[model samples]
Target: MTDCLFCRIVAGELPATVVLDTEHLFAFRDISPQAPTHVIIVPKAHYANAVELAQAAPALTGELIAAAGDVAKQDGIDSYRLVFNTGADAGQTVFHAHLHVIGGKPLGPSGLDLH
Candidate 1:
C-alpha cells in the first residue's frame, strides 16, 4: 500500500490537479486524460481494486461512487462514464481502487472508447 500511486497521491507525496477533496475521498484530474474532463476518484485508504474496496469497505465504496456523481455534477456533465477496471486485462494499470469519471463530449454508442 505504501507504494500505491493513489495512496501516495492521498498522502500528498505526488502532484495532481485536484478537483475535489473530501474527508474520505480524493478526486483529481487524470494526467493522461481520455476525455476533455477525465477525473480519477479514489479513497484515502488503499485497496487493490473495486471488488476489494467494495468488499472491505462498503460504506467507503458507496462514498467513492457518490463522489463520482458529485464530480460529474460539479463539472456540469449531464452524461458521463464511470469506469472501474478490475485487472491488467481490463486496462487497470494501477493496482489501486479508483473510479474514472470521463465526460466532456459525445462518447458515441460504445462510450468505452474515451478518446
Candidate 2:
C-alpha cells in the first residue's frame, strides 16, 4: 500500500482539502469534481474497493456510509448521491476504497446511465 494515492493523502504525504477526518476515516474534496458539491470519503486504512472493505470489516462499511451523511450535512446538502465505483469498468480510477458524496444541484440523468 506504499504507493497508494489515498494512503499518501491519509499520511499527509500529499495535500487535499479535508472535508472530514476521524479516527477511522478521512474525507476530502475531489481534485477533479463531478458535481457542484463533490467530495471523496475514504478509510484511513487502505482497501482496494468497497467489496474488499466489506469483506474484511463489515461494520467499518457502515461507518463509511454514516460518514457520507455527516459529510453531506456538513457541506449543507440534505440530498446527495453516494457512489462506490467497485471496479475499473465502473469508473474506479483510484484503487483505494472510497465513497463519493455528490450533490449541491439538481442531478438528472447522468453519465454511466445514472438516470
Candidate 3:
C-alpha cells in the first residue's frame, strides 16, 4: 500500500487537485478528465478494488458513495456517472479502489464506452 498512487495522494505525498477530504475519504479531480467534471473518489485506507473495499469496510464504501454524491451536488451536476474498474482487464490502472464521478455534459445513453 505504501507504493500505491492513491495512498500517496491521501498521505499528501503527491499533488492532486483535491475537491473533498474527510476523515475516511478523499476526492480529487482526475488528472486525465473523462468528462467536463471528472473526479476520482478514493478511500484514505487502500483497498485493491471495489469488492475488496466493500468486503473489508462496508461503511467506508458507503462514505465513498456519499462523498461522490456530495461532489456531484457541489458541481451542480443533475446527472452523473459512477464507475469502478476492478481489474486490469476492466481498465483499472491504479490498482487502488476508487470511484470515477463523471458528468457536466450529456454523458450519452451508455457509460460503458467510457475509459
Clashes of each: 0, 0, 0
For 1-115, candidate 3 gives per-residue lDDT tens digits of 7899899999999999999999888999988797889999999888999999999999889889988889999999979999999998888889889999999988887644433
Q: Write the per-residue lDDT of candidate 2 for residues 3-108, one digit (tens) a residue.
A: 9999999999999999999999999998888777888999999999999999999999999999999988898999888889998888888899999999998776
Q: What would you estimate as the lDDT of candidate 1?
A: 0.88
TM-score of each: 0.92, 0.94, 0.93
Once superposed on the true structure, which residue ranges of model 2 sit more than 4 Å away at CA?
Answer: 112-115
Instruction: For candidate 2, give the lDDT of residue 79.
Output: 81
Query: In candidate 2, what residue range of length 10 has the lowest lDDT sum?
Result: 106-115
lDDT of 1 by residue, 5-94 (tens): 889998899999999999999999998887788999998888899999999999999998999999999999989988899988888888
Number of the predicted model whose lDDT against the real structure is largest: 3
Error of 1 at 104 (Å): 1.0
Ten-residue stretch with the least lDDT total in model 1: 106-115
Candidate 1 regions with alpha-carbon error over 4 angstroms = 111-115
Which pairs of residues clash in candidate 1, taking residues 3 or more apart in a chain or in different chains? none
Q: lDDT of candidate 2 vs native? A: 0.88
